[model samples]
Structures are given as C-alpha cells and as structure tokens.
Target: MWVCLVVSVALIVARLALRKVRGQKITHGDYWCLCAAVSIVGRLLANHFLLIYGSTRILSAERRIELLKPGFEVQASEIITGSKLVLATRSLLICVLWSLKMAVLDLLARLIMKMPYERKLLYVFWTALFLTYLASIIPVFVGCHPFKKNWQIHPYPGDCVIGNVWLFTYEVSNILTDILLMAVPFSLILSVRIPGMQRLRLLFLFSIGIFLIAVSIMRIVQGHNSRVQSAHTLWASLEILFAVIVAVTPTLYALVRNRHENTTYDKSHLSMGATARTHPGSLAEGDRYAARVWTELNDSASRTDTTSIEGILVERRYETSDVKL
Candidate 1:
C-alpha cells in the first residue's frame, strides 16, 4: 500500500513536469489528480492503523462473545478502534477513486468542447458519476442503525461489522460509473478521422478502464470467497493506483512525441542550411521558399485548438493557394 502511494505521487509529479516542459497551462484535471494523491496517502495511513488495531479480522457472533469477556478489555478496545479505521479507509478509498474519475472527465470535456451535443453528453456523464458516488457512500453511514453499532463489539448488527450491503452497493455503483466514463472516449474515437496507427494507440490507452472493471469484480469475488479483510484492501489499492497511471498516460505520450518531432525538425533544418551554404545559387532560393511555407503551415495550425488527445491526432489540412513558390 505504501509503495502504491509513493508511485502515485511520483506519477503526478511527472505529469506536472511534462506540462511545464510543453509550456501548457494546468487544467482542472491536474487539480483533481492532486486531490487523489492526498486521498491515497490518507488511505495508506488508515490501513496501517487499522491493521495495528486488529480490526480487519473477520469474527463470528460466538467469537465476538468470546472476545468480549471480562479478561479481554484491551482486545475489545483495539477491535473498536479498528472498526472506526475501517470506516475512514472506506471514505478515503472512495475519495481517491472518484477524484481520478473527475480528472478523466475534465480531460474529456476539453476534447469535445467544440461540439455542443457532445458537451451535453459529457455533462450527463458527470451527473451519472456524481449520483453513483452518492449511492456508493450513503450506505456506509446509514447501513447500520443507531450509528454507534458501526463500532460496537458484541451484539452489533451484522451489517455494521460485515458491511455486505455497503460492499455490494459500492461495487455496482463503481462498475457502472467506470463504464459511463469510458464511453466518452470510445465515442470520440469512432467519430474522428485519425490515422490508423494513432487511432489504435488511443483505443489501447482508453481500454485500460476494462482492467479497472475486472479488478472491481475480482474484489467482490475475493470478499465473498475469503473471510479476510486485507484482500479487499489489496484490490482497492491496486484499482486506485492503476487509475492514476491511466489518467496521466495520454499527456505523457504527447510530451514525448512532441519532443521527438522537434528534434527531427531541428536536424533537418540544419542539414538544409549546410546544403544552402555550399551551393548558394538555386539551393538558397529553395531554402527561403521552404521556410515561408513552413511559417504559413505553423500559423494555420496555431489557429486551430488542439488541446486534447483527439485534437492532437486529427489530421490538419492547410490551403496553399496564397503561397507563391
């Protein structure tokens, strides 16, 4: 869990560095990612204390009674503390996952900003995600009656301690939001006219969400098949870590490709300069003409807004009617 937290922090830092290198302004998505990093740290600390307090151990009703006997006051106290930590962990886990979801939505909103219809669809996705998040968290607080039963030891309701209802609610809501979030990118990809290779790369990057859904299913299955609480934490941590990685990958790809293209252009420019210096008659004229055409193309591209993955991949067409060779 600590390792996952550290790696997530590192990825966010790398994302910031890439933005600085590319001379791009920070967007809402970067702020959301920062929020997720803080939540990940909190979840790790909660998990640590939860283990120390011995709250993660599954206990039967008879075992609860045995532990609550007169001789085990310290053990009972530890169990109560652990139960509260369990609650904290659940809240932080939700914060971490949903922050990443918001970050992705922010990027998607920028991608389709020009299309009013697509922008409306993005708003619907935002509303769906928010509603599902509420559905997932409401049960955590209200699933157990009397509120104090959430941390009570002996004779407490099963829903308070076992949380089967909350778990099932969270799993369904989580999977539903993930599917809705992925649909935006897939729809944009289908509607755009990108090169085949670029389209394939975009598809693969967005398809990482499928792994997140699979992980959610595995968490549910593990929770049912095993009596251990640690297994759930393990899967939750993996899901959060993978979400952060997926959110930053597209921007990182753009940064690397931009640098490569710059390097190639610089090398070619130098080669043309050397050739013009050696043969100054016709080659010099050709070099000057090439520079003018390059300037015009750059000016045209600058006029178009290419801030998102789809924008970056879509081919730009330039008219050459005004350029005299």
Candidate 2:
C-alpha cells in the first residue's frame, strides 16, 4: 500500500500541475484524481487487513485475550471498520468509478480528437458492465450483520463473518476492466488516420499498458489469497500496493513526460486563456465546456512535433479541448 500511496501522491501532483498549466478546473474527466483518492482509500483498507492478520497471528491464547481487551477494542473495531470500508471502496471503484472514468476518457478523446467510434455504444456497454457488477454486491451487503458476531470487539461491531464473495467478484471484474480499459485507449489512438509508421510507434509506446496487464494478473493472484487471511493481512497488503502502483504509473508517465519537456502553458499550439465561443447549434454544453477546459489546460503541453524524436515523419493535426478563458 505504500507504493500505492507514493504513486497516488505523484498522480495527484502531476494531475494538478497539468490542470494548472492548462488553466482548466477540475472536472469528472480528471479520472486520475479519482484514482489517487481511491488509492489512498485502498491503502487504508490494506492497512486494516494487516492489523487483523497480525491480531490473528498471536500464538498464545493469553496474548490474544490481552489484545482484545476493552482498551484495545476501540482500535480493533476501527481496524475492522477500515477493512469493511476497503471492501466497499474496492467494489465501487472497480465496478463503477473506474469504469465510468474509462468511458469518459473515450468520450473525451472522441470529443477532443474527433476519435471515431460509436460513443453511445461504448458508454452503454461500460455502464451495463458496471451496474451488473455492482448488483452482484447486494448479497454481501445483505449478509453484513451489525452486532451479531464477535470477529473483534470494539464498541462497534466487526465485519469478520461477511464472506469475500463480493470481494472476489470485484477482483475478477477489476482484472477484466483493466485489460479492457488499457486496450480501448490503444484502439482509439490507433484508429486515428495517422501514418502507418507513426501509428506503429504510438502503439508500441502505448503497449505500456501491457505492463499494467502484468500488474493486474499479479493483483488477482494476491487479492484472491488475501480474502481468507482477514482484511489486514500481509498478502492483502501486497494486493493494495500492486493496485496503487498500477493506477499511478500511467499518470506519472504523462506528468513526467510533460515536465521533462518543460512544456508550459504559453508554449503550446493553442494559446492559453483563449476561449471557444459557444456555438448555439453545436454539441451539448458539457462537451463544449470540456473542450474549452482542455484547450486551456494544455496551454503549456509540449507543442513540439515529436516525429523527429520518435524517428517518424508525419503530418499532425493539433486539435485541443477548447477552454473558455
């Protein structure tokens, strides 16, 4: 989870920096922001998993009794509550939040870059997928008892008996979602009418998603093992760490690439502080607002033609999200 925390911080800093440069305010499109916040939550969940596991590892019956004393109850209850929160968070983020963000990213690409795809189709598909997964969690929610069991004794009840079936569904769906999301961006980017060599180069770079594929696989293995070991166990902790890193790395790369090139607001093709006049007959207000925001946000994004560096000569069309000044 420490890895997640570190990467989460980096994603936030980078996202904030890029937003500042573009002069764009936060919108739902800023999925990395959500990722960062969710990651911290994931860490909290992971930490609780560790606490419960440690509590279980005490060899002596007397020590176990001592650990469960009234004074320690408060802390133990907190740990159990944290674990439940983690499970809930993991489910919501994996099934709903992250999926929505992916769809939004696709929608943004289509809006900003004229990416061609049935946007409605993609959105509907993802929305359905998310809702189905969320629906599956109802069983777990219904199973949670307020004060029936003695998983741990804090003033409040613990979530020890709640089976991890919900967690398992979340993990499996998350792995699938990661692959689909990673693959979809590449598809959208590659479908653009760019030169073959240029397209190949872009795909090669974006194959970085393959790295995330590896992370997802590892997460599935670790998370599945973690369910039996209490929410605060070590194996579970590793799963959280893996998730944080996976979520943060892409954002970090985008941020680092932006910074290394010293792309500032003024140097971009679209001038900073320029507003796109609202076209009465154009797309919805949300689209127009997003466009205006993006243009302002990327004001300092590297406008330099990267063909020279990538060793591919190609024509470029620089369309940006139009941001109102």
Predictions in order: lDDT: 0.67, 0.44
lDDT digits (tens) for residues 1-325 of candidate 1: 7787788878888887876786666768888988988888888988887877766236677778888788988888888888888888888888888898888887676554433254568769878888888988888788678877777776745655677777778888888888887886787666555457656777887888888888888878776645476777788788887888777776566555564323432333343321222221222333332220011001112222222111242321123233332
Q: Each prediction's Cα RMSD? A: 10.2, 9.4
Candidate 1 lDDT:
0.67
Task: Give the best candidate by TM-score.
Answer: 1
Model 1 steric clash pairs: none
Model 2: CA > 4 A from native: 24-27, 31-35, 38-117, 132-140, 143-163, 189-197, 225-325
Alpha-carbon runs more than 4 Å astray in model 1? 61-63, 259-325
lDDT string for model 2 (1-325, tens) is: 4554455456556655775674554544456456546555664555555445443222235554565676876665554565455454444444333533453354334323322233554665567556656655554554445533324433333334334455456556655665665565465455444456545644664455455556546655555425344432343344444444444344444444444222332232243223433332334434432121111112122223422121111122223453223
TM-score of each: 0.77, 0.55
Candidate 2: minimum summed lDDT over ten consecutive residues — where? 290-299
